[model samples]
Target chain A: MSVHLLYAFAGAGVFTIGLFGMVFMVHLLRKLLAFNLMGSGTFLVLVGLAQHRNGVDPVPQALVLTGIVVAIAATALALVLIRRYFHLTGQVTLEPGSRDDEGHS
Target chain B: MTSWLLDGLVVFMLLATAVSVLASRSLFRAVVMFIAFGMLMALAWVRLQAPDIALAEAAIGAGLTGVLLLDAVAHFRRGPDKERGGAS
Candidate 1:
């Protein structure tokens, strides 16, 4: 269906943009946010593609529900770790001094 | 009919907000916009006819995530060490 196709395209775009942010951003929290975007995009694609002639599929819906719960828990743990790291090193990024070292080569 | 138009608009808003979240200069602003983006995404789920996902997105994506992001922002603003001139 055209509606399905449109949503799929939008999902793809969201995924691509999230990947860009995850790869380029220095801030760990931004990377986490981008990761969430990527998760939403994936959920969109899953739900979008599961539609059939009769009606919507329930399988993907259940899976995505699980994914959402898992994602939130993972994000919470990551945030705690990041906060601890910040307290220890006062650096938000994982690889601070190594970035320039990698760029030169 | 009009439903198709709504879908188009929802998708448009999702893309727009997603881009803004990535592009915003201030990390705080980006986090705030990301919360907006998450809620808009819940709208997109509604348009997709997945009320369950819409609810989940609103709760987890927007609500919990927003709370966690705001907490992190507070840490970012309140420097760990004022003498070191924390800017990271």
Candidate 2:
């Protein structure tokens, strides 16, 4: 296979792994990590596939650049929200019984 | 031949780190693995002939995001009581 095709396959694997982690992981931070991983995987597939067909495309690369910036902003915002949630609830995971005393108040 | 070997190595490391980021026992270790994954991603971008992305991945992906997540990890490690105490 071509080099770009190899990277594209790798990206698919990463995306699947991230999807599994996002679904199964209990901790919000871990979920956020999985979300970022998924984004990265998508970016890789975009660039790799585009370049695989058309030899060093600039459009997809630019798109991925913008995506990376947006991703960091989203991650920071998620971390802030997570910290606030932890401060109020004292729980990391969103599983039930995290706020038993409050009782959904 | 050498280039293909190098590309394969980078891809392998990328997947390995991505898995470890989820599978790690400790939260801090997981975040650290994520940072390493970002750096490897930068290398992958370089191999893909996206130098601009490699730079951004190195700066934002590995450096800034790593520091941000590390700070959050430290905050979580402090426990809610301590954080509340310090905040108030």
TM (chain A) per model: 0.85, 0.91
Best by lDDT: 2
Question: What CAPRI grade goes to candidate 2?
Answer: medium
Q: For residue A27, what is the lDDT in candidate 1?
A: 77
> Which candidate leads in TM-score?
2
In candidate 2, the residue pairs with backbone N, CA or C atoms under 3 Å apart (3 or more residues apart, or in different chains) clash, namely none
Candidate 2 per-residue lDDT, tens place, B1-88, comes to: 9999999999999999999999997888999999999999999999999999999999999999999999988788777767555542
Looking at chain B only, the TM-scores across the models are 0.86, 0.93
> Which regions of candidate 2 fall more than 4 Å away from where they truly are?
A98-105, B84-88
Q: Identify the leading candidate in terms of DockQ.
A: 2
Question: How high is each candidate's TM-score?
Answer: 0.88, 0.93
* Alpha carbon RMSD to native, model 1: 4.7
- lDDT (tens digit, per residue) of candidate 1 on A1-105: 667667878888899889998999877878988898898889888888776333577778889899999989999999999888878787777886522111111
